[model samples]
Target: MKWSEISIHTTNEAIEPISNILHEAGASGVVIEDPFELSKERVDRFGEIYQLNPDDYPDEGVIIKAYIPINSFLGETVEEIKDAINNLILFNIDIGKNSVTISEVNEEEWATAWKKYYNPVKISERFTIVPTWEDYTPVSSDELIIELDPGMAFGTGTHPTTVMCVQALERTVKKGDECIDVGTGTGVLSIAAAMLGSSKVTALDLDEVAVHSAILNIKLNKVNDVVSVAQNNLLDGISEQVDIVVANILAEVILRFTDDVAKVVKPGGYFIASGIIGQKKQQVKEAIEQVDFTIQETLVMEDWVAFIARKN
Candidate 1:
């Protein structure tokens, strides 16, 4: 239940890669907290919100957190955890002039502290994702409801990139179309596709954690029969050509697998590509075009771009 908090200040650009490295190290998870998440108290007042837009939020910094189990620190006296934290700090300083702050959390309260941050998030017009602990009753017109408790996986549809993908899904997926959600983080899009009447769905991700999370979410929405979950990459090791291919991943990876994405979709199939910054959209578009696909539409959210293309 005990946790250690280590905050690292780095560029929003560098946080993900560094956080991935930290995850590979020993950190269970790293929350790339926007400084806006930080709150300050006002004199003689209830909590007054600070209007800190992520755009205005300093792009040159990030807060990296790693939790250490209290039992391990107390009973076994694990110096390795401390060493790993120090190593992360050293690594960041060597790579860049970033700073880190480290602290410990009370064991008993650490487990539930994150709950305060994970609340009900309404994703789209027809769908709303609520945490398991939060009470929510969908209106009569609510077409779909996905419940989650983000257990050891990502994708609550809050991240800008993920939200863009979901929006793209809303636009492209139609009744009875087959959908393949590549990098199916937390199964949000796949379930959305199913609820949107994707006749058949296949969800794939290289991460086993994502695959497991996808399966659980798909079942939670009772869409297991419509959506099949698998662990794969860019349609590899799969033979079906879907009507829609949704891959929300880094631009580098998407361009690398552009041909594969095109091949995995049938002629006239929809290809929804997301997770690319505005500057990288041209490269992705060229890659898609090189593979005989044409961009039908583009959606921009913040600095990120999502392309809905068609294999012609």
Candidate 2:
């Protein structure tokens, strides 16, 4: 079989939405090549390491690549993706250098191309995201490992937004606490919550593909007993209150459902919101506050932001 590789060159701010566009367009998988990965400092306490080739990355902006099966409707799909990406401008998202290019590759090449970019990296003090294909050992007895395949989903669980969410979970989750993870792509956060001793976790996603992928990841991490995967819109129709709620989605989407979030989170429980760009931080903060959530902490990493809010 043949596949078309669509590569989009854009800024870090546009990575999340653009990746969503590619997935919606029927991409089998997505790979991100950020120049920042080259200079970023890494700690290898376990001694297992991998080398990165400089030639595979862009010099400035990030390059997002997704594989689309070649078919009669391929051209139409690509155009729709481009249009949807252009539409992001109305939301005030910066789609810098939005240049897209396509190429052809055989099934064998496409299957292995994205694996080179993934490696075991500790995103937080207690959590390390390891690709299923890699072999990694923990350096400390308390280290938590999350195994993810991502498949056709939008996140590897190591993205800045996810990292912050997991970090917040580590700090807030208590033993036997009931938690909910909204837009739980790849089920990474849900698995993290389970590992942190949450008695039960409800992992929800609107996309069927994400729901299935997340379920697979939950089982891979052996957390299926604690995390339940479901297909549902953000906090809609959920009446039972949870001890903690975490969402790593676009700021605009977050704004649309802050009220629902407030309703489902128990008093004194926590809400961890992320996948927000720096420019939209204030807006999201205001929306959360409007729902009576007290802003507890705001975390920033590069151009992204995450907030930990408490319902008092």
Candidate 3:
């Protein structure tokens, strides 16, 4: 089988949204080549090795690449992805140099090409994301490992937004707490919640593909007994109150259904909201406050922000 490689040249601010667009358009695997990573300072507290190639990245801006089967509908799908990306402008997102290109490759090339970008990285104090293909040894007795295949899902459990959410979960999730993970993606946060001692976890995602992926991942990490993966849109009709809720989604989506989130969270429970850009931090914070959630803490990494809010 052959695959089409769709590449988009955009800014860092547009990475999350544009990658999401590609995923929604039936792209199975997405790779981000950000030039900023070449010069960025990283503090690796837990001895994890990183293999980066300066030649693989662009000179400026970020390039997002996704692989989709070269099927009859590939043209239509690509056009829809472009339209969806253009729509991000309505949210006041800067999509600098939104140039898109396409190329073709064999299935073998597509299958192994993106693996080079993923490695074992300690994203939080206790949790480290290790791709299934890598052999990594834990550096600490208390270190937790999350094995992810990533596949074609939007979340690698390694993105800064996801990293912040898992880190916040490490700090907030108590033993035997009931947790709800909205837009669970790869179910990384739900697995983290379960690993952190949440007795029961509900992992929700509107995308059926994501639901399937999450279920597989939850099983892969042996957390299926504690985590349940389901296809649901945000927090819409969820009536059962949970002890904690975590959402690593776009800030605009958070603003749309924060009230619903507030409804499902038990009193004094915590809400960990992430996938917010730095520029939209205040807006998301104000929206969460409007839903009667008191901001407990705000975490920022690079240009992304995560908020831990509590219901009073």
164-274 in candidate 2: lDDT tens per residue?
898899889999999999999899999999999999999999999999999999999999999999999999899999999999999999999998998999999999999
Per-model lDDT = 0.74, 0.91, 0.90
Candidate 2: residue pairs that collide: none
Candidate 1 vs candidate 2, TM-score winner: 2
By TM-score rank, best first, the candidates go 3, 2, 1
As a whole number from 0 to 100, the lDDT of residue 227 in candidate 3 is 97
The local distance difference test score of model 1 is: 0.74
Q: Candidate 1 or 3, higher lDDT?
A: 3
CA shift at 244, candidate 2, in angstroms? 0.6
lDDT of 3 at 8: 95
Model 3 agreement with the true structure over 94-168: per-residue lDDT tens digits: 999999999999998876877887888898889999888899898889999999877777877878899899989
C-alpha TM-score for every candidate = 0.73, 0.76, 0.77
Q: Per-prediction count of colliding residue pairs? A: 3, 0, 1
Candidate that scores best on lDDT:
2
TM-score of 2: 0.76
